[model samples]
Target chain A: MTEFEEIKKTLLTIYPFSEEHLKIFTDKLSLKEIKKKDFLLKQNQICNHIAFIIRGSFRLYQKTEQNELTIQFFTEKNWVSDLESLMLKQPSKNYIEANENSKIATISLLDIHNLMEIDSSFSMLNSLIANLTFPTTQISTLKLKSPDKRYEHLLLNNPDWINRFPQMQIASYLGITPETLSRVRARIN
Target chain B: MTEFEEIKKTLLTIYPFSEEHLKIFTDKLSLKEIKKKDFLLKQNQICNHIAFIIRGSFRLYQKTEQNELTIQFFTEKNWVSDLESLMLKQPSKNYIEANENSKIATISLLDIHNLMEIDSSFSMLNSLIANLTFPTTQISTLKLKSPDKRYEHLLLNNPDWINRFPQMQIASYLGITPETLSRVRARIN
Candidate 1:
């Protein structure tokens, strides 16, 4: 499939669009190849575009005084953007970096607004994407769970994450220390 | 202003709806009075409606094996619902209960879908409301901050929350113990 087709497939999964609407929507996207470890977004930058991963993965994270915290992870077919920055036009406090050599199809905030102006159906895309991608309920509740429970929840729901990301990053995402994660894994295994 | 008008005003802040569209949207909402400790939703129940708080406050929380974890708080002008449950039609794992006697204007999921079908502009309402209210960025990063920093962040951004809710609920919301919260407050004061 073409890089753009990857985007089309993802959008189709979210909302069925007529061929014409799909064409109009995908026509605005541009594809780019990114090398592993390169940043798509950095701290204090405005996230002006949302990108769909046609290949590879990315990690969204923030750097605090003491450490870098992994906020979320995205892989093939997932859309990545700081929604807060994209919506509010505020500078983002997070960084989005490619985890491996990657190809992405991206559409800018301007293009999105233009499309929304052209057709009201286009407005549903952002919300639908946000709802599907951000498991807000899970994120809010996971923090309240015990370290073992959190690890078990991840094991049950997103086992691939364990194999794909480094242990330190996964530990950061779980809000636990690397040593705690190691102990949890040993206990669970 | 009528309770429905409060909903209208909140919607206007999010998106400038045409007068006709605004009227059609607001007309579907019904006002309900909730006494303190009454639930708008409970665990295992499907959340079929999203409510706009016109008066008083509510807490969205989950009961864990060890404790109750407050996920979020909603006050006047804020919209409240288990978006995950409402969107997916899954049973909610959280509870939304009034902290004080409250009046809310709520529109059912079916009405929202009907309105979206009637006009594409109506589709923007859910996403816009979610974006304005959830503050997903803050929630993700807040977990990474130290307990004292979290309290200071709240004091700077939402001092009213400190005053309105009891120390226990706020402590739960912050994912800290009440004793820790007292120490944080004492240190800051």
Candidate 2:
């Protein structure tokens, strides 16, 4: 399907709106191609737009005193945005960068709020966030419970990610050392 | 406000529903009270109900071979139910117990499903999960970046919790040891 068509499909999936309402949202969003290593968001920048990945991947990370830690990776058809920063209109402490040549459609926070006001159906958009993003947040808490179990579960569900993302990034995401990840891989194999 | 009145306000805060719709949900939910240390849910039992804590405090914990860990806690007016175990209809691996005398209202999964089908607004309930419970999840993931930072942030946000919850439980939630937590608290104070 065409990128525009795919975006329309996704919007409808979350909050079904009339054709005109859909057009309002689609019109506001512009698809942009980002080259690998391009920065989508930078530390201390207010992330004004939420990008929906049409093609390619992105990583959200933060640099600590010791290391650059990868917190999450968003691949094709996934949403990647600094939610807290976007919501609070504060400068983001984290960074989001393109991992591969990617195509993403961008929507500004103002546009989303406008759409929510225009489309009553969009009111349930919060439901989408609650269901998709909330559980993901829960996964973080779950990870603290058992790192090895969390790692095993991640591999079981997204085995492809291990090959797609760098080992260092994966280790950061898993809250472990790259050396430890290698050892874990060896043991599992 | 009365417990019944508070339920209406909370429900409407997420989705505006008719008084009739509100009654249907409250009807399915039955109220109960538990003393401190009483089990709301126990390990090895099928958790059949999704409960709302109207008053007091409770926590969900899982025991490892080495230690018993607190996964999460709930205070007044929070939803305290295991989504995985409840949704999957499996025996829970964790136990949820009251930390103090608590008043709760609970509804079975079957009833909630029935309520959803009866009122489309209930389908929008997922956002409630996202906003109310998902932040804890997000914080959990974010904490993986820095355990020390997480502990500091927790203290800043929920000062009373330190006194309310056991030192060991707070340690597990922070992904640290009891000794580390004690030391951290000592340093902070």
Candidate 3:
């Protein structure tokens, strides 16, 4: 399937928009390519577009004075955006980076307004914020689990993330030291 | 204005809907009252309704083996519900309780469906989750501040909650001990 085809399929799966509506949406979308280790958004910049993943993946992180913290990951068939920045029109405190060579279907805030103008009940767009909060569930993980349990929870939820991403990224996401992550893996094994 | 009038007024302020639409939505809402310490929802129970506070306030809490942590607070004119439990139909890990004698205008999930049926663009009903996530901004408080700074934030953002709630509840919400909270207050004074 084409990259556009994957985006259309994914949008349909989430919101069940009709083919006509998907055409209205996809027509406004432009596909963007990013190489590995490049950013879709840098810290303190306004996020200009929302994307539906067609190839590879992306990771969002927050850089504090102490360290860079991984906030979330998005792979093919997922919608990716800095929702707080997009909604509030503020520079985001987070960074969004392409995890590998990636193709993404992108839409600006204006495209979103156009779509909402088209369908008052236009819901797939609403579902994007709901999807964004799943990673905010990470905040709960930090609250609700010990470090070891958090590692186990990450693997159980997204084993593909573990297998595909570098160890350092996963360790940062799990909010543990690389040494601690290695020790946990050894214990689990 | 009556409590119901305030609810109607607040609803219009957030999402402008005609009287006809407001009647369709509000006709389904029943005003319910609760006394201090009674639960709107209990841990492991599904949150079956969303409410707009008519009078008094509420607190959402999480109980572990060692602690009962206050996750959020809601006051008059605020909306309250466990959005995760309401949206996903999962049993919630948190409890919502009245902090004082309280009146609330409430709609069941069935009422929400009825409203959505009336208008496919039925966004006010859709907005309850977005409203719920606003308080989940408390999660950011944990990440962004030390205990003292968190206490300062509580005062800055919600002076009414600090003035109305007991010091213990405020301490719990700030993730600090009562003695520590007292010390912080004394130092400030």
Assess each prediction's global lDDT (C-alpha) against the native.
Answer: 0.80, 0.73, 0.76
lDDT of 3: 0.76
* Second chain alone, TM-score for each candidate: 0.93, 0.88, 0.92
Each candidate structure's TM-score, on Cα atoms with residue i matched to residue i, is: 0.86, 0.68, 0.78
Model 2 chain A is weakest, by summed lDDT over 10 consecutive residues, at A128-137
Q: Which order, best to worst by TM-score?
A: 1, 3, 2
Q: In candidate 3, how many Å is residue B72 off?
A: 2.0
**Candidate 1 chain B minimal-lDDT segment of 10 residues:** B126-135
Question: What are the interface RMSDs of all the models?
Answer: 3.8, 6.5, 4.3
Native contact fraction, candidates in order = 0.14, 0.04, 0.04
Evaluated at residue A87, the lDDT of candidate 3 is 57
Pick by TM-score: 1 or 3, better one: 1
Please give me the DockQ of candidate 3 compared with the native complex.
0.23
Candidate 1 chain A — worst ten consecutive residues by lDDT sum?
A126-135
lDDT (10s digit) by residue, model 1, range B76-154: 9888888777765679988999999999888887787667667766766655545534446555545565988888888
The candidate that wins on DockQ is 1
User: Which candidate gets the maximum TM-score versus the true structure?
Assistant: 1
Order of models, best DockQ first: 1, 3, 2
The Cα RMSD in angstroms, rounded to one decimal, for candidate 1 relative to the true structure is 3.0
Residue B92 miss distance in model 1 (angstroms): 2.2
